[model samples]
Target: MVEADASAPCTDPDIGNVAQARRRTRGPSLDKTAQTRQQIAEAALAEFVEVGVARCTMDRIARRAQVAKGTLYLYYPSKDELLRGVVEHALRHSAVYTALQRKKGETVRAFLRRSLLPTMDAVENSERGLLARLVLSEASHAPELARLYKELAFDAWQTYVQDLLTLAVKEGELKTRSVSRSAQLLASPFWMALVHNSLLAPDAPQKLALKPLVELLIDNLFSRSAGDNANVKSQ
Candidate 1:
């Protein structure tokens, strides 16, 4: 028999104990970092919403957060990165992701569209419109921010579309299609509608117009199944 090793019997409980100890050791640092980031994001949101991204500055953000300018820099190196941080924080905390993750047995299209309505509502509300305007206007100036926005919105949207399309195929409402293509097919029209509303109709941005679209999208896009085909209610 091989000689026994002292650490060999550490096993699952020992390993878990070690992991918990490590987490405890790291917890303080992680919490502090998160709080700092939150402070920066809160400040950035106030600054961006009031001034628009073009007019917002790191100095203003620092003063608003009550953090030193150097502290803000510790979290985000540049203005664009700060903008991305703020947007990401807002979207991440919004009900959208919660709606997506907690949903079960709901068609992907139904759940995501339902989740998206909150975002649309946020974008459309006059009080909240400044973030949307800055997103469209100032995004062009910052390529990183643009990419972050796209990644934040589009990638998640695409992933959800892929799942919905797969379910749609089962329902026979959607034709058998590549998941990638399906993702694109489902994502474009909604975004197109968003852009149209945001850019054109005076009240469109404010109203969101999500209720009708949710119904229409299901009716037109899915192949339809016998079960729950009449009304695709995410609720």
Candidate 2:
């Protein structure tokens, strides 16, 4: 009998069915898909930063990502969509945006301080800061980006803070006439520091610190005794 050639394609029906089954089951793994998406997002952000949103193009982003243009489109169909994706991805992983639950017996003020201060301390040097700067710099040029930033970052944070303030009031840890305004006040320092560092005087040797300002605000906002004293003195 003649020996079968090992190099030849298998002709046996059982072997052919097995081979077909393997082929049908094969595709990009979940890890690979996620990695590719991450690569594309990073590349898009780099392009946006380097050339501004107006000048950045899908073709350029694809080249930067080292992915086929078609592949880039598969992940993000258009520049606007890609910008949204990038911002959402960045915000999702941001320390500042992570959802934190108040510990058992933790005051809302204490929780805010514990949760926000550390993140705020590093905001000026973190990816969160970079995203804020990008939104500020491009807001005038790209209205849609500004809108998305507001929807995804600004308004979301405002709502989150508002909810916390409501909780504080319900728990009797805070006494504010308006939870909305108090939340806005609590948020103002971060924007001020961001503008001071990134826009108004980026090259200045001395930069504003966000953490201390936030810490001070937290103390004042949560000080029931101080509020009481003020009411007593005003009478």
Candidate 3:
């Protein structure tokens, strides 16, 4: 498993606060500018998919967005920044982050279903699916994109999983020794489903469905045998 600095902030220093503050304080003009930036990002996604990232030029993106080249630069100073924008857009619009929204005292099943199932359905049908494919394809060449994916998406999901599992342990819903590793195991299959749907044969019939998988996982992970200690591994 690829490790990330858990202590690291979830958002990019260059993009997150500045833009968030602008949205909170600035009026219609900044809102309009934000919309324009989204337009450019969407256009850039189209251009990138049409002809891979290396060939997707700012000029082409501007034309596709029907905005001036200068206008596009005002939001994204470079293609890399624009790529981050695309990712941010995709993540903000997906249900993958809903795990972080779990209410205190909610059941493990409720939390997992609320977060995981919708995300699986969303990625299977939405532009986020295409975005995942695009990012994976470009990751080999653009390390920053991969880094941003970890920073913005993977780490946040893992952190939520860790928190949920920790809560489960305290509530006697789980008896895992390692919350971190258990969290990884809990989240891995859902993620693989998303990636498989995004990059593999999405429409093909699968032997396992996500709901049944979630049920079995919950049964195995949480249905601790009587007298099981904290050190007991789930079988």
Candidate 4:
């Protein structure tokens, strides 16, 4: 896992702050500047995919982005930092994680539809797809970053699944002694699929039929277990 200090902050330091103790002068074209930053990130992603990140240079990124190399540094201190920006941007706004919204107390099935599927959808984009593959291939070299990616992928799903089990326990729908264990069981297959897709099966069909796998997983692990959760929907 990325040690807290070592993990790069995901947002642009200048723009992400919501408030300050004292008001300061505001830039008139903040939105325009932010758009430019997004453009650079988009261009960098393309450049990195077209040429591997190891081969990509700041000069090339700048040329692709139509921004000065120094300007790119203003937004990102280093190439690694810039790459972090691209990955973070993809995580929050990409097709998969972006639309996977969940209501409080949502069921385990809802969790997958909201979070996992959208992430899987993102696997189809060339730039993001390439980056994801690169991470998988190089994770051994940078294990911390790899672990951070895993946490970003599934931590919330675990929490949401756990919450659903807790709800079921309160309703007398589950006989589980520990909600955490049940949550683990619920999220295991989804996580396993994520692992296979991200690392082991990078060249696998872009659009895998995960529902069948999900059904098999739920059937094998759940199978109307004595303590099985009733409120959590399975598909």
Q: Which candidate is the best by lDDT?
A: 2
Clashing pairs in 2: none
Could you give the candidate ranking by lDDT, starting with the highest?
2, 3, 1, 4
Residue 12 of model 2, lDDT score:
28
Deviation in Å, model 1, residue 94 alpha carbon:
2.7
Q: Candidate 1: what lDDT?
A: 0.60
Question: Candidates' TM-scores?
Answer: 0.63, 0.82, 0.74, 0.60
Q: Distance (Å) between predicted and true CA of 120, model 3?
A: 2.1
Of the pair 1 and 3, which is ahead by lDDT? 3
User: In angstroms, how far off is 59's CA in candidate 3?
Assistant: 1.1
- Residue 167 of model 4, lDDT score: 62
Model 3 quality (TM-score): 0.74
Model 1 off-target regions past 4 Å? 1-33, 49-55, 99-132, 170-173, 176-182, 188-198, 203-208, 223-235
Candidate lDDT values, in order: 0.60, 0.77, 0.68, 0.59
Model 4's alpha-carbon lDDT is 0.59
Ranked by TM-score, top first? 2, 3, 1, 4
In model 2, state the lDDT of residue 155: 91
- In model 3, which regions exceed 4 Å deviation? 1-28, 98-105, 198-211, 225-235
Best by TM-score: 2
Error of 3 at 166 (Å): 1.1
Model 4, span 1-235: residue lDDT tens: 2133233333345542222311343532668667877888888777755655555677777788998755676677666677677776656555544544557666544454455544444454545455566565556665544665566644655775677667655655455667787667655554455567766785887635455655554444344553556545544
- Between the candidate structures 2 and 3, which one is better when assessed by lDDT? 2
Error of 4 at 123 (Å): 3.8
Total clashes, candidate 3?
0
Summarize candidate 1's per-residue lDDT along 1-235 as a digit string, tens digits: 1123212221222223323544766633677778878888977877665665555666677788988765666567666567678767866665545645636657555565676556544554532344545567667765666677677766776776576667666655455446577567544554555566767675643644654665565555554443555554444
